[model samples]
Target: MTKEHILPKWMREEFPELAREPVFQGSQNEHDGPTPDGPRTVYRGGKEESGPFNRQAPVVCGPCNNGWMSQLETNVHEPLSRMIRGLPTVLTSERQAVVALWSAKTLMVAYRAPHFGPRPRPEVILPVDAERLYQDRALGPMMVMGLANYQPTPYAREPLYVQSFTRMEHEGGAYSYCATLRIGHFAAQLVRCPDGMYPPLGQIPPHLVLLRPGASAVHWPPSRPIRAGAEWDSFVNLPEETGT
Candidate 1:
């Protein structure tokens, strides 16, 4: 297997400010259980760390890393750079697809990274999902994507940050896998659910520009912005009932 950088090299070179800044990686697992008042979420063990933003995981094969994955990064370089810099730009339906695909790929790589502690951490994206992604090189219908502008407070700003979580519904045996990624002013979230299951409507914050298969062009800097710190924390950690 070849080592792949979770945060692409181009990103670091383009925004040199991020080269030395620490990146915080964290994961949480939420479960539905009975509480005195009602059913509540039981959060279990999780890991958190702050270290150099440049991280690599030896999880991808040489062909995949050098072939399609590299192409995907190339395809998104220009548009994503603009968005991360908070520059004005329009994301047409086509561009949205590329961004969504790249987001999914990144999330998958992050999930496989060693920072999450060890095995048996909640599995959000299934093995089959990753295989399908590799074969199709596109987002499947089971995945939903959204993008938004992040307004970080001076004290909380970081070059890169990611939070991943899985929500389990005991009654229905349903699972939701989600990850929120932020790079400078650009933020995106991807949710994956089983067939016939959908993410709760309330799970998504209203300010995001939902990226769909055939949707129209979306303007940058959505009307509502996610303020860093509390708002961002809340967005990354969804409520128990929201199915993330």
Candidate 2:
């Protein structure tokens, strides 16, 4: 397995001011409550239970994890981190593609976490498949990606969030998988199944301020005015399926 730094090096490089800030990682804590099925591990930010928490995930293979995946991180880190830090920036269509690739990579690693709970069973796509997918510039029919914004509460501690989830879909499908990675108040949503298979995250609780990349424009510090039918919108108003 390869060593993966949860917080990519580009984070500090892009935002030098935050270089000295403490970075927190999520750790899988022991399963506590009894469940009908069995015990499942609990998840908490590493800072919650320990003094020093190194941000690392060592389960991915070296070549695949460090090579192409690392490249993806490098390409997207600046824009994604800026989005997370609530900094002013614009995400072009190409930039959006990079962010989607990085988001998928992050979700794949998080899937290895013991406490990551149940998700829609993912299709096994090998490293070679990744190259093929990348070249094609698509995550296939099973995956969908979108962006969103939110205003963080004063007490919010974690700047990043990564997890997988499933929904009882609108159709007959019982488990439609979805994954999300949020940095600061910006998030990239990836659904591993087709639209209409499940209700989109925007349609659910904690509705998000969704971002439409090509159709809309993004300006940080929310006070900046965005044009009508643009990138930023209430989830309820967006199309059911919007992503590359």
Candidate number of the best TM-score:
1
Cα lDDT computed for each candidate against the true fold: 0.74, 0.49
Task: Score candidate 1 by lDDT.
Answer: 0.74
Clashing pairs in 1: none
TM-score of each: 0.86, 0.57
**In candidate 2, which residue ranges exceed 4 Å CA deviation?**
12-53, 114-137, 155-164, 167-174, 194-244
For model 1, residues 196-215, the per-residue Cα lDDT tens digits are 77655465456787876467
Give the lDDT of residue 74 in candidate 1: 96
lDDT (tens digit, per residue) of candidate 2 on 54-163: 35567667886768877887787777777776666776666766766677666555555433333222332234434545566446545566666645454645334433
lDDT of 1 at 201: 45
